[model samples]
Target: MSDAQSLWHLADGRALTLAGAAEARRLAVSRGRVWLTLSGTTDRPAEDCWLEAGEAVALAPGQTAVLEGWPAAEFELLVPPCSAAPGRGGLLGRRLFGG
Candidate 1:
């Protein structure tokens, strides 16, 4: 099995802007609740998804998604886990995710 990874954290009303790849991004909440807004593209419309404690959500790649906390929340991104090689979208992997 691959090792686990951490994505980002949020406090009440806080939000994080993230980029996803062609593969869906797997987001798992560790505490509290979170809401997601998937941005629309020329091909697709926007969408919203909600997740509570112990719940998770998957987001399609190729665009940015917004993650906001209900009150307080901790989450981990499953897909496209941190990699040594920089992927599409950004190159500041270590700066954004961690080493």
Candidate 2:
């Protein structure tokens, strides 16, 4: 996993921008639903998939997705080469649950 990172929490009716040529590897949603808008492409609705109470999506290298209409949604951003490993639980499990 690379050390690069970006994180954001968006609210309803709000939109976050992803600069052109920017590359994001993973996005973990911690809260509400969000819409994704790719650069040079039309904005589209993206369902908020729940992994845990505070975990959502994880992308691979060169994968990019914008967020919109994510009211009160917490998201942890991970950049290329720094992908989340499989089989390992989430922060809550490792922290409170003691995975």
Candidate 3:
């Protein structure tokens, strides 16, 4: 895992929407469960599903996803290293480099 892979926590019953990403993303649940709605495009139909801990979904660049925490959840939005911003350092980097 890369240092840029940060974790997100959501309380049960809470929901969040992710959209307009510059690049594709992989949403992975680390703990608990989540309900997700993936917006449809001309070529693909919209999708609704449940993701348990250790499951993941691949989201396109322009796709939209609505995620609701199921009895609380923790997840990570994984972006490709090539897609990450250059010269940007994250928490792990800051801790390791002491910068």
Candidate 4:
């Protein structure tokens, strides 16, 4: 398998929102430095830690991570449930239905 399938890129000053138990995994970088802020929960970001370009960090579930600064910076992000994994379909298939 090619690693290209596992790569994701985010533009500067852009934020991504995740719902439910979803998790975001990827490699990211920011020009000078980037800040990640977690809102809607009791979790807070580490003090004075900026995400530099060419760094990898795994965003914890149930939190929103915001990327700031750096234009043209790129990163790789891998969402949960493994897109190429067998037997696992879309979110609808994983939901419960009443009889």
Candidate 5:
């Protein structure tokens, strides 16, 4: 994330629902451990993966997934850069537009 503080924060037994797992490029567990479960799609059944703190994983496009903080966790997600980010518009936007 551009701003590290914006990282996803979760409590014990809490979960973060991700809608565009397909568009997601990477997931990083910054604190504690988490269970990442990919939802079933047309061609495949659901799959689950685990990540401890400091671990990062690549994600396949076009999938849905649920991230859970089994016992408390914090994580960050990196998606493909957008044409225009909400604030600085990302590196590309800033370079092209000249903020």
Candidate 6:
């Protein structure tokens, strides 16, 4: 998960959950569509969304997300090159999801 970007494929009806995120990241759809659910924080309400191909969402620190493919999908999870740090969570620490 340390790479700048990682590609993942989700089968129809399959789901992926990203939790305990330590840094900000982006999830972009490369092919097909996805359904996304983001956990709420003290400052904001929880959200549910649908993303089509070429769409993207920003995930905040200390949040979590649940994603499901709509008839199969390909996507990428990306992190900024400057965001990684020593002793910090490597993509699975404090997490913020959605936006």
| Cα RMSD of predicted structure 2 | 9.6
Give every collision pair in model 1.
none
How much does each candidate deviate from the true structure in C-alpha RMSD? 7.5, 9.6, 5.2, 7.4, 4.2, 7.6
Q: What C-alpha lDDT does candidate 2 achieve relative to the native structure?
A: 0.53
TM-score per model over all chains: 0.65, 0.46, 0.80, 0.46, 0.66, 0.79
lDDT, candidate 2, 1-99, per-residue tens: 233556677877887765443443556666676666543334333333324335555443344456774455667766543233433445643564344
**Worst 10 contiguous positions by lDDT, candidate 3:** 90-99
What TM-score quantifies how close candidate 6 is to the native fold?
Answer: 0.79
Better of 5 and 6 by lDDT: 6
Q: How far does residue 8 in candidate 4 sit from its true spot (Å)?
A: 4.6
> Tens digits of per-residue lDDT for model 4 on 12-50?
676544343444444355334455554444565433345
Q: After superposition, how far is residue 17 of candidate 4 from its true place, in Å?
A: 4.8
- What would you estimate as the lDDT of candidate 3? 0.85
Give stretches of model 6 more than 4 Å off.
Answer: 1-3, 86-99
Off by over 4 Å in 1: 1-4, 41-44, 80-99
CA shift of 58, model 5, Å: 1.9
The lDDT per prediction is 0.73, 0.53, 0.85, 0.48, 0.73, 0.84
The TM-score between candidate 1 and the true structure equals: 0.65
Candidate 6, pairs of clashing residues: 20-93, 21-94, 60-96, 61-95, 61-96, 62-94, 62-95, 62-96, 63-95, 63-96
The all-Cα superposition gives candidate 1 an RMSD in Å to the true structure of: 7.5
Ranked candidates (TM-score, high to low): 3, 6, 5, 1, 4, 2
- In model 5, state the lDDT of residue 91: 61
- Local error of candidate 1 at residue 64 (angstroms): 1.8
The better-scoring model by lDDT among 3 and 5 is: 3
The number of the candidate with the highest TM-score is 3
- The digit string of per-residue lDDT tens for model 5 on 1-99 reads 443224888899888887754344677899999999987767678889999999987666667668989799998876655422456565665676564
